[model samples]
Target chain A: MRELLRVAPGGAVDLGAVDPRSTPGLPGREVTGPQRKEWARGQLTLIGAELGRQQEMLFAEAKARQSAARPVGAAAGGGGSDAAAGGAGGRRVLLVLQAMDSGGKDGTVKRVAGAMNPLGLHVRSFGPPTPEELRHDFLWRIRRALPPPGYVGVFNRSHYEDVLVARVESLVPESIWQARYDEINAFEREQADAGVALVKVFLHISYAEQGRRLLERLDEPRKHWKYDPSDVDARARWDDYQAAYAEALGRCGTDAAPWYVVPADRKWYRDWAVAHLLRETFDTLDLGYPPAGFDVRRERERLLGSERTA
Target chain B: MRELLRVAPGGAVDLGAVDPRSTPGLPGREVTGPQRKEWARGQLTLIGAELGRQQEMLFAEAKARQSAARPVGAAAGGGGSDAAAGGAGGRRVLLVLQAMDSGGKDGTVKRVAGAMNPLGLHVRSFGPPTPEELRHDFLWRIRRALPPPGYVGVFNRSHYEDVLVARVESLVPESIWQARYDEINAFEREQADAGVALVKVFLHISYAEQGRRLLERLDEPRKHWKYDPSDVDARARWDDYQAAYAEALGRCGTDAAPWYVVPADRKWYRDWAVAHLLRETFDTLDLGYPPAGFDVRRERERLLGSERTA
Candidate 1:
């Protein structure tokens, strides 16, 4: 599933070549309609539970590493082998989601990222740059929001906007936007070295599906706030945006930070795929609870008795 | 349920007077054991859905208020009546959780606030103050983490810790900690005036329960990382913490930010109470999607046809 969705590093990405409705890794695609949706949801719940457990281990490992800095190890020589320094190493995950309006970025996060404890998760949504943000380099705010050593950070519409929107809308000069491709790869490599495993996702939806979603936003009273007039303006230039995305995905894909193009037209498949990818990412982390930072026997005795430490 | 759980503003609190195991607002206390736990979990799922919907509406309302600043209302007079101006107003909710170790603060958040969209949610956990944080006023970091116009912010451990831990540990002089009660009230009031509705929850657990939980952390290899040796030290001073929390709850509870004492010995009840409180808080926000910012007829036409505005 991970291999199917991952954009090969330095490979040409033609958005038109892949079908947005494809459920690539789904078992036995013979089961269509409601049954498929049901299967995806069931799998998502199990995947989500796995994601949650991994995130807790990530947090627990950090806490162990941090508190291990205090008393026990130096004086008492900490009980077990890993007790002095903690079991798991410091490795963080950053998931970046980019898509067109109504492409289901919000929905995917609600279903996939939502499974993890909010404590170990930091979800940052970057809208168009504010006046102050515009003054700084585009990566300034992006860098500030990066997850710390133990967290799973999510950027909903991230720095890729610098290339995607800038190129599609001519927000910057040709020379500048074109140069960002290399700049982004370099920045991502640095993050990877710093223990940030980047999972960049593009929610791929067909043009027809986008129109349907936009119309639904207009039709439903509860969804009216989601329908911006400018969305239509953006839709008018859909081909330009697609070309920009294809170029950006092809150019920026790297071993350090690869892009995953999820078939977002089927919300069920999209949610399941992202959750599965996250589970796969964290599964490789070798995560586990640290050994006791203190002597287990001593602490147990201390807890049982209301007295001074041994 | 809100009234049952809320500690009255300026009222004295005696921790010993309340039973930590008592399930308030769970219909028919006669139904004991797993059935009651089962009922609470079922209610939680329903309440969580409501919470999720309200949170989305809160985010939508903010988006409308922001974009309502541009175009629409001022030009072409938007569409019809109320079309220029958004219907829903700006209101943010802040949930603060405080507890002794093993009081289920993390569990409650995973069960309850976990239901909301993480996009509109900002979960900030405040640990022991850093050296730089100590130089500033205690409320300094609290203010920095406050929810913005649209977000629903959460504080895993908040400024109340200044009173709880500082008083219990004697980290600050009696004079300093004594004066902080009013300082907290004033700060919270200011936040209330600025569109933040504070929902303070203290997950109340018995000393015996804490001991049981600590032992479980030691017994389970997967949970060893959660057990810090100092937690036993904290447990030794259980009475002092209870007194400190009692005083803080009484003094800090106000109409603007009331303290809810959730009997957290029962995990299901604690999760249900907090989720119920959040639903009731946002239920009063009168949340809804804003009126159409642009002419719906024109936008529909634009979406159907790939062309310029009408």
Candidate 2:
């Protein structure tokens, strides 16, 4: 299953290869050109349906476990119970990104983490640090956003920006930001050793695509409010930003927190790839339905007030 | 149309309400519940559908405008135009609350605003403010969370806490926090006058209900992490918080930003009511399909390429 979903060129598999028509259980057949687009759309629809089904199953199983007064171990995967239906009491996932802006961060979140139970999902979108944050060590803000056990916390532009953006714009001296790469790798290694699963995604988009989007924002009167001309100034530093990304990806791309260089020029492909990554991560946990002997129906009836007057 | 939809408790109407079972233009109808719950659910579903439709229309029209080199207003009120599609700009809404541990603010956001277009939605969950926010007025942290044009922003525990929590906990003196009611009213009034639509919902769950939820958190190992013993200290002051809320709502509930005293003892009811409020608010805007003759097909075709280059 892991090999089948490998991240390919363009940040996603060629949906055409699956040929939905030929692929059993999938919705569409493989075709060429616009049909490929249709095939991708159908696959997404199928994925949505399957996600809904899995969520319902998980919810039901979790409720059953709660009713049964099961031990905490039973809820986690250690007891041969369904891991997907249980909580990660000590498991953590950290998502790191560079500057978010409009470069597909929000879209990536919606597509990838949207299906996760909200209680198990945490999002921390970083901006300029507060006085207190600045006063602390540089990684303090990043450390604070780390997910608790059995949870996934996404950092929309993380501590890496301390090195990437600050270095690119010379906001900090070269000497300070240059040495910070090793510091970051050590920090991430500590987290990984602590049982945190960190996945870093770099959304790579061409300057032309960004400009086109910005232009669309300006052209629409309603969207005119979202337009900030200052973004263009940042765009002008495209090469610098690219170099910074390449360096950061090269330095920090370790087994602990492997970096996925995603071609984000195509929004659909980015969404698909991110969702695939998340599914793969969770699938590895080997989640399943909880053990038998729980009477969920009786508990549900009691909760719904079988004896109460409607 | 409006008269048919409006149901008086016992008054007679000239036209019958649209029958969900028999309506041809509408999709299949699911049983909506009874009384307030029914009203709430129906309104929420309507609002969700309407918002989704209008957002899709806006994006399509915006893309078309970009290609034609025309301002959005030129297409406005016509099919695909902003006005016709209910694409009013510079209208913002914010939801604010106070918190103890395990307050259902996150649940409220997911259930009420879950169907909203992510592009038009922003959520800011406030924690302990930083030195920068503390240096300024109490409202500084909250004021920053207000939505930009054509967007909805929700604040989970907002500026009101400065008065409600602080006054109750004796964190601030009476004279200082007491005067804040007027300050808040003035600020909200300014927002209302500037075309911002604000609805404040107080999730009025009883102390007993809160205790039950808290106990559930402790009993369930997965939720054990959420059980903060410190919340009991705050729970002791439930009456004070209620008194503060009653006074605040009584004083500040205006035509512009009315406060809904939702009976949140029932989570389902609370979710339904919040969604209803949003539906009513957006429905009042009279959003509809964009004006005709936008030639969306042409624009989409252009993007897809008219002929296969390969």
Best by lDDT: 1
Candidate 1 residues lying further than 4 Å off, grouped into runs, are: A29-34, A70-89, A307-310, B29-34, B71-89, B307-310
Fnat computed for model 1: 0.42
All models, RMSD in angstroms = 5.3, 11.8
lDDT string for model 1 (B201-281, tens) is: 999998778888989988888888877776776777788889989999999999998999989898888898899988888
Fnat per predicted structure, each in turn: 0.42, 0.01
TM-score of model 2 vs. true structure: 0.55
In Å, residue A269's CA in model 1 sits off its true spot by 1.3
Per-residue lDDT over A202-246 for candidate 1, one digit per residue giving the tens place of the 0 to 100 score: 999989999999999888888898777877777878888899899
Q: TM-scores for all candidates?
A: 0.92, 0.55
- After TM-score superposition, the amount by which residue A216's alpha carbon in candidate 1 deviates from its true location, in angstroms, is 0.7
User: Which number leads on DockQ?
Assistant: 1
